[model samples]
Target: MAELESPRVMSKLISFLSSLLQRVAESNDLNRRLQPQKISVFHGLTRPTISIENYLDRILKYANCSPSCFIVSYIYLDRFTQRQPALPINSFNVHRLLITSVMVAAKFMDDMYYNNAYYAKVGGISTAEMNFLEVDFLFGLGFHLNVTPTTFHTYCSYLQREMLMQPPTINSAESSLCMGKSSKLHLCFNDDESSHQQQQQQQLAV
Candidate 1:
């Protein structure tokens, strides 16, 4: 009985983690797909994907960023998505938006932001490169950076709830996973992009 239960328990945990990561990737892809695609950056492609998760992933990896950064980035994307009346933006344009959103998010959310980010060091090509990407992203979303999920009413409710709960990891990861996806939030648009990236690589141009 113990042996059987162990496999079942592990199976459930793996499923939960996979589901969480899927939620994150979905959010990320949604934001990317909403970009305007009528640009050169999206053409000349095969085995195409919705966004440059790799480019965004690279920039994020090179930066001394935080979870707050992901929050802010997702917020920015949500805001942009909400305001934009258009869709099907190319991957390049979306990538630019995400990078700029991260920069803008850092400025808005943190006291001191990282300046003088060298492209070589940060995995971006250059400041000009950054600007170019930001502009395109901004253009696609129509510069809608005002609205976001972080400020949503339900999010506020969850924060209040999270504060009341015992601190995270006090319970097993499975316990945390079982609580719920809506409030627990194992994934979101900007977060969890790295999870299951291997499957993503197989399916995408990356």
Candidate 2:
């Protein structure tokens, strides 16, 4: 249990700080490469055709959730959609698929706990339907739920150390308490999925 929780609860918090700063410094330097020449079947996923962005943005705006979160949630939807090209498409069907994907991601990423009932209540569905969707999504992803990465973990770790390193006159402990509340708020921001195969390949290659 100690080994399991050690890295989960505490990772020398110092080491995580440097790695995070590095990622931040490098984030802007990274470029995307979906060569225009290549034919991606889902290239239809691009905006000029479906305008998925505007469609999702409208729904998420109603929910008071960021368009970015819905966008990332669609990334998860595509993880399954890309593999199976024939999934049915409908108004509420799209929302159910996308929302269920995000809930799975929230469960993995949020420091706070989430349950299917919470999704059902907000989604105005029975808990049984949420459960079925959850199961369907898992099976679709080959029983994978550990795929999403939480950017909050690094941000929280950095905030903790930043508060710690401040001059003593600032009341370091008090500063930490104040920052803790703010960090909790940012954790609500849905983070982007980094690499899908990285987690799977790393484990399997070992």
Best by lDDT: 1
Candidate 2 lDDT over 1-206, as tens digits, reads: 12213433333332332232223212211212211122222222322322333433333333333223332443455456444434422222444565576666655434443467766655545778888888877777564444344543444444455535652121211111122344421123244546443211111110
lDDT of 2 at 19: 35
How many times do residue backbones clash in model 2? 0
Clashing pairs in 1: 35-89, 36-89, 36-90, 37-89, 37-90, 96-133
Cα misplacement distance, residue 110 of candidate 2 (Å): 1.3
Q: Alpha carbon lDDT of residue 170, candidate 2?
A: 19
Q: How many collisions between residues are there in candidate 1?
A: 6
**Best-fitting candidate, scored by TM-score:** 1
Candidate 1 residue runs with Cα over 4 Å from true position: 1-37, 40-60, 87-94, 119-123, 135-206
Task: Tell me the deviation in Å of residue 176 in model 2.
Answer: 45
What's the CA error at residue 67 for candidate 2, in Å? Answer: 8.4
